[model samples]
Target: MIQDVLVLGSGSAGLIAAVSLKIKIPRLNVRIVRDPALGVIGVGEGTTPNFVGHLFDYLRISRRHFYELAEPTWKLGIRFEWGPRGRFDYTFSPQMDLQWGDLPRPNGYFCDDEFSNVDLPAALMREGKAFARQANGAPDIQPWHAFHMENEKLVSTLEKVAMEAGVEIVDGKVTGAERAEAGIAAVMLEDGRRLEADFFVDASGFRSELLGKALEEPFDSFGKTLFCDRAVVGGWERGEEPILPYTTAQTMDAGWCWQIEHERHINRGYVYCSELTSDDEAVEEFRRKNPKVPESPRVVKFRSGCYRRMWVDNVVAIGNSGGFVEPLEATALMVVCGHTRTMVDFLLQTELEPTPSMIALYNEQASKNWHEIRDFLGLHYQLNTVEQTPFWKRCREETDLSGIQDLLEFYRENGPTGFCRYRMPSNLSDFGVEGYLVMLVGNKAPHNKPHRVTPEEKAIWERHRTANIAKAKQGIDVKESLYYVRHPGWQWNDEIQAKRG
Candidate 1:
């Protein structure tokens, strides 16, 4: 039976794994082993709606408290300087099924030109606003949108909650581990201490200390499909610029640069293929684009893929230990929360030595999730036409379109209308028809024999665009709206006005 659990590494992944496990099980004795000397990578600045749902519903953390401490500005979506048009906004809201009144097709068919202003959130982002304004003149928050936060604040906040809930935080490094017949029996710290647990959660970032180094698990790489292996990450404090409620992904010489907004600061990073451009050259390109960045970019090299199996014997790897992809969609925490949720569910159903079938099912689920992300990200690079550098050209010609090939083919055959009707497995494919449609339409992927919309349909699309733009004008900026929500006397009584999350 699984009683005691030890989570190694104390980043966001480790804390989340520890707390969520304890929260779900309630009976599991959980403790975290961490080395405080390892400084935090305070660059993760974006998340998906799944993370927000996890925050409010699953984790039960206070929404108000999150804003007050995390220095987060809401993110409606990402503005992509990608594709042939060289600019489009990928909002959190649905674009695929968003049809006009008595229209033959969804609005996406008409979004080929005005893609940025196609959605309500996209319109708000174009206007440099956070949310649509309610009649109360307050900035509204949408459930569809997510947050862009400072990484240090998030990890520290989670650590506090986990510790408060009885997770013993041990400060030390795991120097070694004791192996057993089935899996790891215990871990040895640098302080010459041995700690034992019925099960181990390896949240050890990229090191994969327990699962990779100790267990020597075979890795399943997606290098052929996802080629970004390095990031030159750096940012500057906010200035007179408006705090956007969306992240900006501008095409770079080698790969792409992400502009993430925080309340007091702006974080940016350039993820590039090391083989196409040297670290120094990527740094030069990054600094050239973002001259305000006060320092040289720090190079972080990472392989893009996951383990053969996330759960092996008595050890389960979570976060970067299990797998890592580029921060293209900010899927790091998604995997963390996802794996933790599944692991907790499994433990609740079975014991430490879960049968081989149970393990296979878990591994298959995790692998599918990882592959889905890999393929989705691949779609982004494969269709991007804004840049024609050696790296991007190679990506376009070489990257494999795994899993989503059928969907792409369907669109190629029938255009962007029938995507919602396309059936897909529930293997944790985070991006639904909407997500895929946004990227596909945003990139202007051609549908053969395109049906021409009459002037009437065009007028309807234009009317919707005008209405969205006008509504966005009433919305407030990220800075002002967050303050309004955080005011000690703030209150909400609206389904009429925009909402808050």
Candidate 2:
């Protein structure tokens, strides 16, 4: 039977794949081939709530170890500083969908002017606080929100966890591939050992060692829709600056700057189009904006797209090796978590060797997932009109939002009502109608004829917003909350932990 798996690279993708498979199939031999010379991207990475759910629930990694090693801080939502509305939050929970007490329409139609306080989490994000506090105000348990992490530490933490699971970690690099009829038969290492396995997972980041270079998979670029390709990244030691609980995405001269929060340091990066802004100019602008950044920022070059097929025979490319989009919405690791989970389940369900139809189905689902991530991020650019710079102006004027055209038209007509739910796909969609609705309402997109709310409905909306604000005021900032959780007296509610899994 198929009992062994060789996973390339030791990044989060490879380690998670190895660990999950070993956990799922107890007798399987899983070994990770990594190159010691190459280093991880080491930038700030963020995850969606699904990732949080998967790690502790599906994969069952220890939360205590994760907190201790990853140095994670809470992220309820992203505070977007873009478009006409200036600053708004796309929270984990549905912001506008909770129709308050039989209102004539959803509250979004009335939130065109001031919208952030519609949901409790969004309001909490606005005030730089986290958690929904319980009575007596001891920092309550963390919510089902995501996390902001140092990417390098995240990978290392996962690697340690994999080691605990009996996954063999080896130091090696792929020099060549020994091809066979349906797929790769064996991978040749630089040291001349040929490692063979029933399945191979290519998680080699941009190098894409097995799938891209070895299998020679054709790439489909999202260049038409998502254009930014480079990031000027840097951070400084955190001293006395207040540690906020949300990621800050601020619009800049040419592109945008992302400020990711951490316990002892704050990471910042400028993602911009190289066509409109040069490396030197981007770096200059980055320093101009973030004066506190100590050393010169490093630049990371990347493309926006995926392989034509995520699964090809015995090899499946996960993470950046498969495809990538700009860092908008913090999709990288979330995508990694999802594809890894799907891949492991599929492998086990198929009796360890995937059939042609299985591979085809996986490809179809993965392709749709990649494109949806593109369209969702594209939705962000299509409606943004905040900065008047060449990059932002060109984005508003030229970006191809054809993928989400029908969804956009529906929202424009219906105005964030729960009526258009059937239009979006239930599977392979990263964020459902909830994500789109938040971005749409937050940007104050125009509708030809808006829903009129009665005085009674308006009163209810105001009361909801007021209640959210009061609850947020009772909550504490990120550092204080994390310290509370790390205390010796801290104990997770048994009921909550059981449901979390």
Runs in model 1 deviating more than 4 A are 351-353, 420-427, 491-501
Off by over 4 Å in 2: 425-427, 493-501
Scanning candidate 2 in windows of ten residues, the lowest lDDT window is 418-427
Write one digit per residue (lDDT tens) for candidate 2, span 1-501: 578788998887788788888887878999999787887777637788888877787877777777888878888889999888788888888877667665666777778668867887888887788876767566665555899988888888988889999999888888888887877888998999999887888989999988999899999999999989999999999988998888888888777899998888899999999999999999999998899985578999999999999999889998899999998899988888888888878887888877789889889989999998898888788788777888888988998888777777887777787665656644476577788888888778886657676788778778888999998888777877887778876655543577697
lDDT of 2: 0.83
Query: How do the predictions measure up, each by TM-score?
Result: 0.95, 0.96
Q: lDDT of model 1 at residue 501?
A: 34
Pairs that collide, model 1: none
Give candidate 2's TM-score: 0.96
